[model samples]
Target: MYMRYFSRLMSAMAGPRPVVFSGPSGAGKSTLLKKLMKEYDSVFGFSVSHTTRKPRPGEQDGKDYHYVTREEMQTGIANGEFIESAVFSGNMYGTSKAAVQDVQAKNLICILDIDMQGVKNIKTTDLNPIYISIQPPSMDVLEKRLRDRKTESEESLQRRLNAAKVDMEISKEPGMFDATVINDDLEEAYQQLKQALLEEINVVKKVNMSS
Candidate 1:
């Protein structure tokens, strides 16, 4: 069972570092993240990002995203309120500094799920987060996974594959990420992810046990 008592252990012991998760689409990043958070919900919190796009059905403001107008987002960006921002499909998306601070203030490690560009942008700031990249075993495997989803058109699938190629290559660059997890098997990959964070986990455990 999880040590539920240590919900605020991270904040009590130390200023927890944020953890950034980035990978190509269909690399199982979201799945792995879901598993981690489900098991250690108290230890991690996801920072809500801001977007200029319209919300889809069932999405809540300040929960799914801090929905904003284009003018508002642009103002925030100009004011340097965002830690990282990017324009896609004529809409802007970003993680604001306040969002990360909100999670940290709750005594939890803020988890950021972003793209390669966001990673690079964060690197310029002083957030000093642990960067982790999730990747598929190979391009062939990634292609299969995307296809198996059965949710993409041929053009969209090809576009994702193309982007994945660039993402995979960037992941290999020197010092781009602290850890690179190749998701060959779900269980094995999850174990590897936990292993990489074992030090932090143990720290939390030690703090909880001592208290």
Candidate 2:
């Protein structure tokens, strides 16, 4: 019995998990996720998304996003390659199942930085994903962050801010996410996120044990 228990424990420790981060633009989802990747070597930063947006300065293909043309994306969609796809601000974004499988194959936890709509699509899949919503400390701070980016025009910034308000309200809805972290203090937020991942893994282990 002791050996059986030890084996089970070892197997559980070796297995990978899937984590999802959902939030609106300028909510610091990407920033927090990038920090987590740097701090946790075991994490597999899933390059799950393909986008129509041109790579920003210093952004590398396959590192930031798989850059694709509109025609290629349409063909991929026709082939049912993506688990979810969405268009925002005239740019196309998609998450491919192949990307998730690539991470799982390496026995590392796959983390996705996705939007709220993409989260809904992921829920429909067989993957048992743990969702985390990264929120700004306040709308004022969120606006400031967006403006500081200097990547958008005034009209676009206003649109994003308006969208963020709606996203925050949706995040507050029951069953929308497993956990929420406010990216006000970077260290504190990262700590909370790490703790939440451990807690979810524990819950899954308990479930497996009972079964």
Candidate 3:
């Protein structure tokens, strides 16, 4: 009976509030994510993404991303080492199984910063997560932010604007995500995200008390 109870307990604790944060290029997704990681510190573990693209200036390996060769990535994919992966702009990016495991082993909430394609793929898997999409207030505002960054060429900036349009449209789909957050106000958006993450713990506590 104790063994059975232990099994149930583990199952309950197995997927503790891992979040998949998806948004467009200039949607302040990374900004909000950094706040969570920095403020919460020990509570969240970032599953560093793997990419076949060469690192841009100031990016670090295993810190910003795990840089790998296309050949190596394909081999790892064949070996079942990636949970979800996608090709964008002729480069491969993925969340590796090892990266997730590393965070989970520490009992931290693993945060995955993936795209819409990765989000779609993850839903089919058993690694259930709270899906949240951060959206800009408007396309014009999104365009302004991208332009202000000055990090993109005109062509790349246009591509991002188009992608944002699609993302905003899809985010409105009821089943695509658990929550759609507008990032017009940074602090307000952060508060919303923080509360959502906290709710998972609250739910489990309520269940335990009743059980």
Candidate 4:
């Protein structure tokens, strides 16, 4: 039928999609992402974020983040050069459209490490990325992990814990994420995260081949 042909045409055009990783501080998001990058090598790439904040010690221009001046950032926003931009502590932070395109151009998965707000911001765009939330098993474990890893003061720790509480709650909402992987066990969580991230990729590949 005509409908079948149309569906196959759409499938022929299908390709890799981006991946969004959202979670709270001290959640094992970074660890899992590191493993994926290390093992898969060139299968994925990071969409470097742009920031108005001054480059920190030993930080590179495009590797760590695409550091830009406030004026430049504001101009980019006005020109619609960014997929999403937000202000934090007087610094303008954003992800450029070109940054994401760079990864896609390389035929690699564009992985974004974002907060809940960033996740929501990305949802407004046409990029329908696979959303995966890395959450701690419980608030108690989250608190302990932050305390052990970070040397921040007790007050700062409390602030982070409170923010994690909010993130934990929001992540439970239906349709907020395609998959929610609890980071209770690092190896187990990584396996789950890897599977969720790759399923979308497999679908795109299969569709392209069959079409």
Q: Which candidate has the highest TM-score of all?
A: 3
- Clash list (residue pairs), candidate 2: none
lDDT computed for candidate 2? 0.79
In the range 1-211, model 4's lDDT, one tens digit per residue, is: 4345434433442336888998988998888988988986567889899999888778899998999999999999887777778775467888887787778766677888888878888787667788999999999998889999766689878877887888899999999999999998899998898788776556545554565
Q: For residues 1-211, write the lDDT of model 3, one tens digit per residue.
A: 4345434433544645678999998889999999988987666789999999999999999999999999999998877777789987678999987787787776677889998889998886667788989988999999999999998899888888887888888888889998878999999999988887887646544554565
Full candidate order by lDDT, most accurate first: 1, 3, 4, 2
lDDT of 1 by residue, 74-166 (tens): 998887677789875467989987788788776677899888889998786666788999999999999999999897789889988988999
The root-mean-square deviation over C-alpha atoms between each candidate and the true structure, in angstroms, is 7.3, 8.2, 5.8, 6.2
Clashing pairs in 4: none
lDDT of each: 0.84, 0.79, 0.83, 0.81
Per-model clash counts, in order, read: 0, 0, 0, 0
Query: TM-score of model 4 relative to the true fold?
Result: 0.82
State the displacement of the C-alpha of residue 191, model 4, in Å, after optimal TM-score superposition: 0.5
CA displacement after TM-score superposition, residue 160 of candidate 1 (Å): 1.8
Worst 10 residues of 2 by lDDT: 6-15
Greater-lDDT candidate between 2 and 4: 4
Residue lDDT tens for model 2, 1-211? 4345434433443446688898878878887777767766554446568999999899999988999999999899777777679888888999876787777666567787888888888776656678899999999999999999999999999989988998899899999899999999888998898788876445544644565
lDDT at residue 187 of model 2 (Cα atoms): 87
TM-score of each: 0.85, 0.85, 0.87, 0.82
